[model samples]
Target: MFHKEGHKIIIITFLLVVAVALGAEYLIPIPWLQVCIQIPALILLILILQFFRNPKRHTPHNDDHIIAPVDGKVVVIEEVYEKEYFKDKRIQVSIFMSPVNVHVTRYPLGGEVVYSKYHPGKYLVAWHPKSSEDNERTTVVVKNKVWGEVLYKQIAGAMARRIVNYAKPGAQATQGADSGFIKFGSRVDLLLPLNTKIKVNLHQQVKGGIDVIAEK
Candidate 1:
């Protein structure tokens, strides 16, 4: 199924492609040139439709486990100092999303949102060492009964220009539920307790709301 967030853009693109194809058929006398123009336009619409597809996922409900927030490859798993809400050392797990991967972001666990903020910055590569802090991103913190506080940030990559967030402080978040969406490619960074057990390794492919990335 297609994502609701892309309905408007997808419809507009579909209409534009139809208009262009009809215009070329009637206005252009050369049949060969009309086929060339219409072919590329059709391909463009197909690619856009594929990018916004939202497959049905069963979100595992476990307070001790942390689900992956986006479909991508595990890029980094390291301990770093978190300066935003925690201001302490924490384990960070980063997933890098390509243009072909789903751009939807989901909650890692069920909890109450403690912090939600947006930061506008440069559009660096998703895997850059400083991209988590330097790139346009949104920080969200959820506090659960099993895990005190878990922080996740959605960072925009060079190709991703828009980041949509639905998290708000004091709101309840459901595990594996849609939290936001990023246009194009991007990365997601999760900051957990320093001793949290990580289940995935670097370069491992993960699916949003389906793959368990870590545990308490």
Candidate 2:
């Protein structure tokens, strides 16, 4: 069976290698190379383990309404002016993905991709006020019959340098379907029409592709 959560194995392997390397250094300390080489190894191990430890909740069925696109704490939920594409009033829900959380991005609603674009920019902190505009990100607009046009952004944060988005214009995407994955820490911004009802609140912990973030 394919390990849906295979990151855990990578963490375990990292820890084991670090332990062995530390043991080897202590057992055979050389002249100037006597310094411990395990510090960096330990630090890397900690980071990798933390990333895999975050909750890996299952993505809900496609029939469900708007599910969350990333696992993280809901940081923003208010009417915001979306400038890049919509350039209009939208209810923006921002989820802050820590280094420990899953970096995958999922479709929030079922629809055909009407527009998709990638912006190359700086890697600001995910929550930085200008990160959404300044940071490297992918904007995807999906047109749905029930919800009209819904926009989702895959934003690359300081630690996350790569953002993988598979959505292409004219492609059909279903709610809760795996749309892409981000490496390391990041954030996801969902831009919905102001009239959409928010089902979650700021600071609420959410599971990507599982927890409903809003409804029509």
Cα lDDT tens digits for candidate 2, 1-216: 212354655757676876767776777667345345655566677666566553445665554278899889999988899887889999999999998787768888888999999999999999997888999999999887788888999999998877878899999997777788777789999999888889998899999878898876
Q: Weakest 10 consecutive residues, lDDT, candidate 2?
A: 1-10
| Model 1 / residue 96 / CA error / Å | 0.9
The alpha-carbon lDDT assigned to residue 77 of candidate 1 equals 96
TM-score of 2: 0.81
In model 1, the number of clashes is 0
In order of listing, the candidates' clash counts read 0, 0
Looking at model 2, the pairs that clash are none
Q: Find the candidate with the highest lDDT and give its number.
A: 1
lDDT of each: 0.95, 0.81
Error of 2 at 123 (Å): 1.4
In candidate 1, which residue ranges exceed 4 Å CA deviation? none
